[model samples]
Target chain A: MIDSGIRLPWNRRLKLLIAYDGSSFSGWQRQKHDRTIQGEIEKCLSIMTNEDIFLHGAGRTDGGVHAEGMVAHFDCSSRIPDQNFMRGLNSMLPGAIRILDTNTCDPSFHARFSAIGKKYHYTVFTGKVHPPRIRLYSHHVTAPLNLATINSCLQAVVGTHDFSSFENSGSRDKSLTGGRGAVRTIYSARLLQQDKDCLVFEFIGDGFLKNMVRNLVGTILEAGRGKFDAEQFAAILAAKDRSSGGPTAPPQGLFLKQVFYQDRTLDHCISGKD
Target chain B: MIDSGIRLPWNRRLKLLIAYDGSSFSGWQRQKHDRTIQGEIEKCLSIMTNEDIFLHGAGRTDGGVHAEGMVAHFDCSSRIPDQNFMRGLNSMLPGAIRILDTNTCDPSFHARFSAIGKKYHYTVFTGKVHPPRIRLYSHHVTAPLNLATINSCLQAVVGTHDFSSFENSGSRDKSLTGGRGAVRTIYSARLLQQDKDCLVFEFIGDGFLKNMVRNLVGTILEAGRGKFDAEQFAAILAAKDRSSGGPTAPPQGLFLKQVFYQDRTLDHCISGKD
Candidate 1:
């Protein structure tokens, strides 16, 4: 067994509250040659602890999808203080990825398995000109969007549903899904903010399948564009077929805003929203 | 004269309201070979109009400084409607630089010579961790700043003063001084916003010397950090020597927020600030 020169246990589970700008990475998963958020963090942790450390993320985000509170866990015997890991990792990793917080947790706690829900934000710029500063964080559509139609469409996605119509086929492994398959519960779905030229959509769900949020956004956008009404959007959802959904929205506009473990209430997930 | 088939003036002055992410560009000014906001736009304008186009910026922002409403002007014989220039140039130009608005102005109206004043924003992140999403746009400082002291210090800079202490040497042409060397008017200087972990400083002035805003921000930040008091800040201004000023703040936090022409009222310069 590895020694930390102390009486404490050799391996302790540490959970990291993370954030990353997804523009520079291939994605969140580790690949052999590609740069990924997980791969970079794992390599940094391994170097810091002098052990091969594998990080378990709450979920995988596709390339160009940003995150503000992505959770991950890894075990190490380095004996370093929890705060030092945050500081060290932030200094070692590229500016695109940051360790927001770190803490030692019970061995039973798992970043992925223990996560009860996740919150995401998809921002769209409906203005004629997309400002350069926010171009990376928002999708631009010059066409005027119907906010009433978008809100009505969003209401249909709140309950538990088999979201196969919004899931991209072959993007997930069958075994890892743990028999849940396409069924997921969306606790809250609404537009958080609607400014003069921008819309911020917030979704808190039990879990998401691969590209589920983007697909939902794309389909909802079609309804907002008058391609369909609320009834048609619900019909598409009821179809439960992958081919029934609209195109997948681009990744840049999506952000994994937060992940919830024990607290799944709307008030807890959102700031000051009842 | 260039033929447009339908006859209009061969040399109509066109004004452009522009924005850019300055991290990827060398600076606003065009160099022989270096990538610049002006160079890229000029090249595209030349290609579109089939004539060598020269762009005149209201002012030059240093490398890594962003702009949301920078103004410029150029003369061309192209009969393309004003709207088409905005659309066509945006398509040809990189996403980092955008033309927000384009309009034909009188031949006597020069972007640089006719400019009245400019407004700039300096954003600082005081949180322990700078979010990756805003890392390119803000400066991070972990130390708590004295907002009261900062505001008091800002009050000293709200009138006409010789700001040579904040001007960098060799950055401006001596002949361009126009007989009022090192002196400029500051109509407004104050802290625009103070959120949980961020402070935004706004400066509106008749004109600014090279590196004036950044140097002033650095010196004011020094006062905010208790390096000096308001009286001492005024004394630094009175010194009129560049050596008396504090360090020059980084360029990333600076933004050319807007440029004023003909209108100089505070109500017009800021949105709902009056």
Candidate 2:
């Protein structure tokens, strides 16, 4: 009943690393009345390949969120050459969405399901006045912050814990299965480059709930602004409630910087197209 | 009668150094119904200041012709603070159109009439393939050519001449104000930095007729391809007819790099803005 070795329907699946400056989009997912990057890609793919090609993302990012190494997967029956796919798909996509790399997978490699650990980088430009060039890509923080204080707070949120304190209250569980609660294992959380204008916070984890990274960023930002210290941050995480969390940060600074997988079984032919 | 000293018009004329990426726009000038950079800027200004703003440009750039330092002038009766006018006008403008610098000028300082010389840069990517990152800003040429040969031919068209051969035969003759073709002076037209992938041609002259730079670029591109040798280029200039010109290159590669003003009127205010 498992059908592990049944080569009868061994279809082809493509894994892709897509980057987008999502300023003019509604989000990664398909919406009822708004334009989404996924919807655009799906529509363009269906037209170009003459098939109903649905796109699956590693995770859906909110509006205004940018990505440099965002991952996604889709199955297709067309016999298009892999070397030309990157050019073709990119030609269809607008200037904002860029297909950085692509590869053929074992048809079972779902971008979300097969992931082991994911890493996200949030960039914030901390200055009294933000420069014009980096305003689009980074969060402009006018408040004065100390790096040592923020790092101390970030260290307490790294390990395994029930992350109810960091979940977005407005976000709903969108899976077919109902009443899901998050108990994700956060491998590491460190505020990297705390001493620079372009501040980066990298979070490596097995899996993440909705808006988890952004919420964590919000918490760290509060700690940086001296609203709460490291011990207070730990106590808030121990509360196990959304009300105990800090304010959710804006999506503009959060990036799906890199997506991790159990097996990066990608071919050169597909990746070479870029 | 010129209103002098005692009575002055309430509206003041301001000069603006505008920069734009032309890929998303129709052209510099406004069309009947289509979208153009000039039209968008004027529309935004009209909306912001509650006045009908008209844009008078130094030169007319065709569709897909970008500019780094294009010049334009406008008069506004609104009580525009010197500091706020530059910022407010740009804040209302689209993201692509940036007011690089601003200056208040004499009422009679027409953007087109007061111009001394214009410097345009034509960028060509000469390699086996075009670079994806810079594809929008440059032209792609696959055939390899000798740099020394191309550089030698450029030395011939440096000085003053009747560049009818480098003007489009069928292009508009608006420069023939009184039925005489423009006999403008060409200070320099040289090709610099000719290596593996990039060739930049810098043209500085008193003025340029319609499609003159494109025609010049086409002529040089042909010479670089070994079709038009040095002697043929000299003959083309001597012919004093547009039919003698070579192919007209695409408009994407050309950028209005800078418009040089003889006086130091702009540098003072530009320094303050910076």
Candidate 3:
């Protein structure tokens, strides 16, 4: 008995490119009380569509961690045009969060599962006095860092290895359930001089465990400051024990730059214009 | 007949290079009821030295206007070292303002009167949607602008001219007191592409009348949008009437980059690293 009048549910998968300051957000995850990126977006989308919409983000960035090109997606029953969805969502969202772009994507395009790799940047301002203008965007390190040492240490970080030492304990249980161990492939790692006093550390990898990027930056900074040598850093990585690594760097200095997918089509969709 | 014990005062003039996020400040001038850059600095200095300290800024930036290298000077009778002055002021001042560098300068060094030239930059974000991260630092213009047209129009603005048309009414009274007319020399004017969607208008001139930079940016943006041809823009300048010019642009996009002094010794004081 086919109910012909029960019109087939019209569903569309919408992908969004989002950017947020993260200074005011608890994180990307939705929480009942805390203000979060995902919570804010979902609340706005639900009001706009009159349906409870859940957002799936590529990465769950921690509090005080910013994003320039975070990817997310959701299924919507409403037939809102792509451009209108972007404009509507942005208008409803707070000034701290923004939907940079919106597009219709294949149903199978999952923001998290389909992601192949991700890139992150950590900025450090080594000026004598931290400039007030960039205080939120960068970490202030009054001590000058040796760039040559930092670059040399990065060379050792650019390869497949078990990054358990770099992962915080909170994410260990989740990694264990996957049964793939803590081994992850790092495609590249490099140190960039943003200006005379700002140093940027960029990492591109297959995946990152919670606090992995921050921990790596902290450890690398130690080597840059001659607190430890590259050999000692390599030894810490081989230990695979969190206690063997340096302290996790502050969250404010970290930024999730972009998430990459295997589909070449999605690459072009990520606006290279910005 | 001076008391021998009351030695002649050794007042040291200290120059400070400051940077501030103007979002929270009323302006650079000292106001009785409003929070301002000068007022904040004076309060902090008064607390530190128990003496009334007055700061003379290189430019009296309007509300919501930012500065990267604003120079200011104050006479200090307390024998505090230059480094200690910087550290003490920063420790007491709010996080929104910071002293980038501090040095003892010649007593004749006046932040305003000693300046021979100044540079200001106005940033416009021409992206489809303004990224929330840079909203306070740049003006968001959704429509695409023709850079070539803007550059061509800038050619007409490079030389010295009577900028009366671009001066706002609030500043007209001050300009009239000079009796030299509204004639001012513009050393250079150019359009710079900061990134894919960020256009930066850089203006280097002997001095700028109040609201002159904002008005010029407004008129130049109109020319970029093809609202008025280059010849019309030239005529607007020739008209020497405020009503003939475009509306004054908003204050958020304006930044006082540097103030140059004619003295070769002071010239070296400007940080060229940035």
Candidate 4:
């Protein structure tokens, strides 16, 4: 402590708030051959810091799934200012991905492990003619839907329950305590009318299984179309079997809107309501 | 008294409300060697009707300029219903363009000549880190700007005035009664704070010269940055010289929002505020 001249490792941990269109990305993971959100960001960080860097995202969004407030963390030894990270990464990243904000964080702040909650949004275009400008960001449903029916179906999705029926087969592990980890808590499920032609479904949950949001939306949509009555929807959830749920909706309409942490200092990054 | 059996050439004039993300288009006009909005639509119509079709758009948006409600008209002898045109054209056209609505119009109706007014929108992203998802639709301006100063500049842009200083030199015509035709009426000009980081400039006018809206935004931005005072901006407008105005803003931030026609029947097309 007396020798102030001695140099110390920067040993700084950085957090990043990222946004992407997801039209061209394969997914959020780092794949050897496929283009991905994590792969792209790591490449840019490597170039900027001149060192191999690795990133851990809050969630692994599938291909064609967008994110507005996806949180990530990386450890770096570079002595550059925090602002430079934002500028340098954005300058090197593709036009489809952006570093919305950057900040230095506590070394113990893990992107995935310390996360407390997540919010997902799915958009459905209910217009007669879907606009080309938003085709990649919304699911076009030309069939008229009964909103009241869909809202009732959503009520059956909230609360702590076994959501095995909503999980995709590929993500299931029967060996994990006999599939006891399939339980998750949903705090709120809302259907917001963004405009005359757009309906946004928002789900805030303590956790989500693979393909859970899309499958839930698919089940609710079927109810809206009058294919399944309210009683049948409850029965599907109670079955706890994958075959009991509807088909998974397309991935293009799904978005990881926000990742919540315990500190809540990063809440400013989540701007604007859907 | 008319003969219903014989079709009088079917001489039906149809008007279409189109929306497009112009990132992939060369412009609204048809160029022999470029992909354009008009060229793509006309080609689709030709394939569907098996006839050479010509289209007239309300405005010729430059390359990279988007449109939310651009209007166009075409004449066809095909006896298909109006709904078919909307479905057929959309099915054949590329994903960047969409036909929102289609209807048969009076033979006297024209897309450009009959337009009584037009509205254009320019978006400027004032955030420190520009979101890549909106890079093609907004201009990135990181400099802090004064909203009061910009609003004062915009106040001077409204009302009738000679806009020669705002027009691009290539679009100017000195032979039109010694450039007297440059005088046009601006109905309203508004600077909207879309969010904490986005500023939208909306211009409504009876007519606008080429590059007028972009140039006006450029000038207003300069004033917002304290580059010029409100007096200097008013002086620039009065100068009536192209060199007196600020540089023309980039085309990517520009949008043809809507076109107003004298027939109140078309008023329904312009719904919702900016």
Question: Which candidate has the top score in lDDT?
Answer: 1
Cα lDDT, model 2, residue A230: 85
Write the residue-wise lDDT of candidate 1 on A104-205 in tens digits. 998899999899889999999988888899899999988778889999999999989999999998878888788988999998899977688889988988
Tens-place lDDT digits, model 3, residues A68-123: 98999999898778889998988889878989889889899999888888889999
lDDT for model 3: 0.85
Model 4 chain A: weakest 10-residue lDDT segment is A265-274
Among all windows of 10 consecutive residues in model 1 chain B, the one with the lowest summed lDDT is B264-273
**Model 2: per-residue Cα lDDT at residue B171:** 58
CAPRI grade of model 3? medium
Model 4, which residues run further than 4 Å from truth?
A1-9, A172-179, A263-274, B1-9, B172-180, B263-274
Q: List the residue pairs that clash in candidate 4.
A: none
Order the candidate numbers by TM-score, best to worst: 1, 4, 3, 2
Candidate 4, residues A215-273, lDDT tens digits: the string is 99998898889898878998999999989899888988998988988535333333233
Residue lDDT tens for model 4, B1-274: 9766745348889999999989989999999999999999999998887889999898788899999889999998887778988999988988789998999899999998788888899999998767756788899888889898898888998899999899987764456333458898887788878898999998888788988999999888998888998889999999999899998899889988889886353333333333
Better DockQ candidate (3, 4): 4
Q: Point to the candidate with the largest TM-score.
A: 1
Give the chain B TM-score for each candidate: 0.94, 0.87, 0.90, 0.91
Q: Write the per-residue lDDT of candidate 1 for residues B20-102, one digit (tens) a residue.
A: 99989999999998999999999999999999999999999888999998999999888888899999999999988999999
Which of 1 and 2 is ahead in DockQ? 1
Ranking by DockQ: 1, 4, 3, 2
